[model samples]
Target: MPGKPIVSSNNAICLVGGAPIADDAISAVFTFVNSFVGVDGGADHLLAAGVTPAAVIGDLDSLSDAARATFAQQLNHIPEQSTTDFEKALTRVSAPVVLGVGFTGGRLDHALSVLNVLARYAERAVLLVDAHEVSFLATLGHVAFTAAPGTRISLMPLGQATVTFSGVRWPFAQTRMAPDGFTSPSNEASGGVVTIETDGPVLVTLPRAHLALAMKAAVRAK
Candidate 1:
């Protein structure tokens, strides 16, 4: 069974999953998110934190009876085993950008799976945010954003790509990158604005403070 579709007026939505999410992080998500979608056990977390999501989407495997009772109307169960709950929600929702909390900072495998989903869904602008960092898949285009000087920026190739980047401590001019080979990590932004141009998909990571800039760039990239 697949989940019911969600119709959202807002272009951006927050996805709360079953990972550790800080209180401040939840507060920050609510500040910008026009709606919330809970993934299975994440609905329990949201309810525990006094948040009622617009919809709860998952395979119905991890959600508790108490959570189900509390938000029965919001449950949209998808009984498929092929995809993770995060991917299921991502495929079902329509948004210009999706802010993901509680999807990272968990078990290493889970975090890696989230990144894989971001890569697979390159057409969707999804930001996987944790306490310290924000990551998104960079598609074919020029992504420019503002960040503080000395802020950490990392670029990991999701697939085969040629990229050119500037406004950072180390600049790459038409550099070839691939998943099996090169990755630029621990790079620092040199000034207020940083830009990266890629012919294929890559993952861009930055400090959490630059969430607004990342979101802006993602929207522009779309």
Candidate 2:
């Protein structure tokens, strides 16, 4: 079961995770989301950057001694082994959108776990940002955005999905996608505007440069 919200906000909230995060990539996130929550050891990252998170939610397995001491009042420990720290924090946060960093770029298994959480919480508008890409759940069933010609757009289905696309180099319609079957990867925008519509859970990924547009599409989908 999902936990009750420990932090709620009208604006987007950024969740910092324990995985490695690029300095520039993490900095860019702060521009879009001023409010922040730390997922366990994520609080250590924020402290290093000299930013204080509103709350720290996780199992505290990876939390650093300094972070625990510094954010003593903000600490929120949920000692559950059923879910990853990312899911623990994500479920406890309420916001218009959730921007996550440091959830990728570490162990491949951990990154995959993050994707699983995104699919499980498909109704929530969440974006996972890495050094080179911005990824999110295509919960709206349809998403439209502009990108320069040849910009890469990848879609991976979390469940069975039928999809259609336009303004892409290899546009397709009624394409069935599933983890066990075909998945769309490295498709590029031909130019101008690109649109994608899906009937089931799908993950969309784009270049980091298109973060703003990705965020807009996620919010609009919600």
Candidate 3:
């Protein structure tokens, strides 16, 4: 189970995971949120970047000796093996939105696990960002945004859902979507406003250029 809050903030917070973080990706995140929460080994990344997280939460298994010693006071260790460090830190932080970095662009299984956590905690406004794209679980079951013509817009269901779309080259309405059944990938936006509505959770992904808009839409979803 997720433990109590370790860091709560009115402004949005950023959770750094154990995956390798690119310099440009780290720079992108700083444009939005300053408050940071390092999950286990992620503390080492933050320390190297010269930013100390307000708190660090995880099982402490992957945390490095340097990070452990540097952020000893900030550590909030949860020794349970049931959850990943990303899930542990994500659930313990309270904010209007969470921008997750260092959670992708790594091992395939680890990247997939991050998506699982996003789907499991769909109620929270979280955006998993990486080098190329930004992904978020549309918990409110709907989202609207504007993108340039031919821009890539992908909607993937972690479970099952009936989804509808507009302002896309291949629009679908109330069509059942799921991991094994059907998925929308490489869909192109037709320019101007794009609207998507779903009856259940759907993961929406767009180019990293639209990160600001994605964050705004996510915060307004619920």
TM-score of each: 0.93, 0.95, 0.95
lDDT: the better of candidates 1 and 3: 3
Q: lDDT per residue, candidate 2, 33-79, as tens digits?
A: 96889899989889999889999999998999999999999999999
Please state every model's RMSD to the true fold in angstroms: 2.0, 1.4, 1.5
Clashes of each: 0, 0, 0
**Which runs in model 3 stand beyond 4 Å of their true positions?**
1-3, 220-222
Residue-wise C-alpha lDDT for candidate 1, range 65-87, written one tens digit per residue: 99999999999888988999998
What lDDT would each prediction earn against the true structure?
0.85, 0.89, 0.87
The sequence of per-residue lDDT tens digits that candidate 3 reaches over residues 108-181 is: 99998988888777778999998899988875656788889999999988988999989999998989999999
Q: Give the TM-score (vs. native) of candidate 2.
A: 0.95
Best by lDDT: 2
Q: What is model 1's C-alpha RMSD?
A: 2.0
| Candidate 3: 10-residue stretch with minimal lDDT | 1-10
Candidate 1's displacement at residue 198, Å, is 0.7
**How do these models rank on lDDT, best leading?**
2, 3, 1
* Clash list (residue pairs), candidate 3: none
